[model samples]
Target: MWLSPALLLLCLSGSLSLTGPSSVTGTLGGSLSVQCQYEEEYQSYKKYWCRGQNEGTCDNIVETQGEAKEKNGRVSIRDHADRLTFIVTMENLTADDAGSYWCRVRKTWYLGFWSSGTSVQVKVSVSPEKAMMFLSSSSSVHLLLLVFLKLPLFLTLVGAVLWVNRPLKGPGGSQPDKEKPSRSAPSPGKPCPGIQPFRPDRRDLQTLDSRAGGQQSLDSGGT
Candidate 1:
């Protein structure tokens, strides 16, 4: 099919679309991996990982020539010709690492500069780890506050129980001595100081008379 130059470029650009996620997240002091897929025809082309807001002016961090794997400092790029995909990895992520990034294919040269080519924008943010740390610190502070608030009440209850169970004291603050019972009977051969001689009452004399009468009656009946 015959086509104008502008139409031809548009067709070429449309056929070189790159597919990947619009955004990615990584934790501080951690690592992250991104996969960018391209067409099979461009599998042998160079693939690069860059960082900047503008895809046309972004600085390349790591790139793989042909089908080789390349590593530069904390960044690495590996291209898989069989899968028509390139993988970019960043290690030891930090707050400074959170920004706009791009995975691009170097397809052709246009007007003294390499064309922006097919790429996907990836936005990275590092807030999840910070939020987790904040929640943990706040939880610890709350636990400490609860302990501090209840400590005085616990001590007060313990002191009251001890006081209620304490032993009674005497006039001099010493424990009181137990009381002893007095002896009802006097010692052997020792008379009681305030005792008088025993005397028989009317009821005792009546009991003696009744016993003598019963004995006399028994003797008469026997004779």
Candidate 2:
């Protein structure tokens, strides 16, 4: 008796579930493959597996078993005689290829068949190409951060310079002169030793008194 595609999918995918390695790592140009298995004998339902990296949507890679065949370039799927077992391959992977994969069972006629899922992880390992990209991008980010930080520092420095150069006011609020007084004072004249009041111009006092007396007598006689 021919089992309905839906019942077969449920048996292999839902009930049995495909068993496979969840993750694998390889280089950019390296050949990569993933494996999965189901408990029941496959009864002719189309089987397909998809790959999705980093939580992205799974993309169809391979198809086999009963009514199965669908895939994009770079992905291949093959099933063993047991029908539930599958081997998946991807080639020439870039960083974008890294992600999870799911093995699915479906009906060729309508979406009727039941389905199961298995994971696929294609990791393009460390290479100079990726390393260089990381360094250059990271360096640019740091440079931008430094430039932004310097703006505030530069403004602060400018403010300090203006503050130092600002003019000061005097006590009466007039503009103040900046010049300071010298430490040494001017010298005084030499001291004279015990000297009395000295008069350099000396005249005859009696002659001056006689002239004054004559003038006074003439004035008295006239009066």
Cα lDDT of all candidates, in order? Answer: 0.84, 0.62
lDDT of 1 by residue, 1-223 (tens): 7899998887577445678778888888888999989987677778889999998889999889767788999998999989988899888888899999988887776663765467778997765586688899999998887788777788889999999998999898988778867668887877796987578999999999999999999999999
In candidate 1, stretches whose alpha carbon ends up further than 4 angstroms from where it belongs are 1-16, 109-116, 128-131, 134-223
Candidate 1 TM-score, true structure as reference: 0.60
Worst 10 residues of 2 by lDDT: 118-127
lDDT of 2 by residue, 1-223 (tens): 9999997875555534545665577566555777766555444555666656542366666677443433458777766645556677777777677656666654343364643333334333423454567789999988887788877788889999999998988889898777876555434653354556554443667777889999999999999
Measured by TM-score, the strongest candidate is: 1
TM-score for each model: 0.60, 0.39
Candidate 1 — which pairs collide? none
